[model samples]
Target: MDPCTYKRYHKHDQDSRQYLDHYFSDKSQMVFGEDALIFPIKSLTNAFAAGHIKGDILLDISHGSLVHHLYSACEFFKHMIVLKIKDRCILELKRWTDKRTGAFHWGHAAKHHADIEGKSHQLEDKEVKVRSAMQHVVKCDLEKENMTKPIVLPPADCIISTLLLEAISKDQDDYIRYLRKFSRLLKPGGHFMLLGCLGETYYTVGRDKFHAFSYSDDFVRKALEGEGFIIDHCKLQKRTAVSDLTDYKAVIFIAAHNKK
Candidate 1:
């Protein structure tokens, strides 16, 4: 199914809301893995705090689940930019790729794709340039589209984006594009922070699931370097036996800006 439909299905109506409450409260395999968006931001906040991160400027990508956590974490920031892009762009959908090797792969996960189960899909792309400019690094027009070249951004003291890029990239190039899309965010003398699923795959809504792409730590590092984020610190965020779900951890990246 497309993202619009998936978003509709995920709407917190009274009935679906009831299911979420029960699902989150469950002490079994089902609930623990099901709830990812909520935990990553909380975990990321604590991780940044663990490093004693406090600054006067901040930027966040993917505004959905991370909104509350970011607002709470960056109280010192005089400016904060929250970004929301396609979780899975219906217009820019691409096939899955290998997490480590960046190779194309497909599977017959028929049990999951009840809707759009056998439909032809296209590769999706996000404007990494436009996205990079959105985070208060500089003043760029959000009203325009189809930019010819990337614009520059002001160096921020700290930047945070969560669970983005991984979901939008259908192939390695797309992943690189997603990373390059954010290249301009870090200015000289700036810092960076990102939290994403290390090997996250599959998205299920009320019993409907779909195949998803996840990136490895190596892939993430390469993409960051490709985008000008030189890695200064990296951490394995959390490994919880909180439930029986496969152990998926958030890889946190803290890089320093080297650009003049």
Candidate 2:
């Protein structure tokens, strides 16, 4: 298929041009953490819920501030795990988990917190005193980085991540190394979906730079085969990320899982 231009919210529109304005336009404005857009994550999660793609544990480190991704877990998976690696992500999470429910959800970044009742991360509505105190809270030293370790995947029913692989090692060897890293994150026969910009130029948030890495499925397949993952499917979706009216090419990806 030849590359073509497209809109940014193509999934909302089967035609890839008509962007679904919102499920509920007025109600769309979330009161608490309106700064974060949870709609797309919600859309993807809803698709997972409607299907049989639930996993025992799910992790999305995309750094997207979409909070609805968490709610979808309530319907899709028997077990759900989430991690917020950034402060903005935490803010988005806290907004939806306000103490009004008399429950605190953030703890050790897992679903286990939901199972056993315990003290965990709490939501705040602008407690300057508390925020100030956290400044003085010292964090533990970083773990010793290891390289050249034999890469292996951990067993999980499924794994899904977006916009993360781009942040890992960039070259072919590093890309293969990342494939090996995720291999350790998935179960022997697990499934996963990686949705991203196959031809993205660049995007920066705060001080971070996310560059696009476009490769054919054949290229991806060759690399993953070496890492124990087989290419089960490949699709080029008409993503709603057209930078200009003339750009038809959107995001492309190779979705697969463990082979052996």
- For TM-score, the strongest prediction is 1
lDDT of every model, 2 decimals: 0.44, 0.40
TM for candidate 1 is 0.53
What are the models' TM-scores?
0.53, 0.52
In model 1, the worst 10-residue window by lDDT is 106-115
| Range of the 10 consecutive residues with the lowest summed lDDT in candidate 2 | 15-24
lDDT of 1: 0.44
**Tens digits of per-residue lDDT for model 1, 1-260:** 45344322112221322223233323344344323433443444445545545565576654232222343344346566544333322111121111224212112111111112222241111122222223432222222342112653345577676555554555578768655556455556566676666775544444544333566888877777766666766766554435323234554444444344
lDDT of 2 at 51: 64
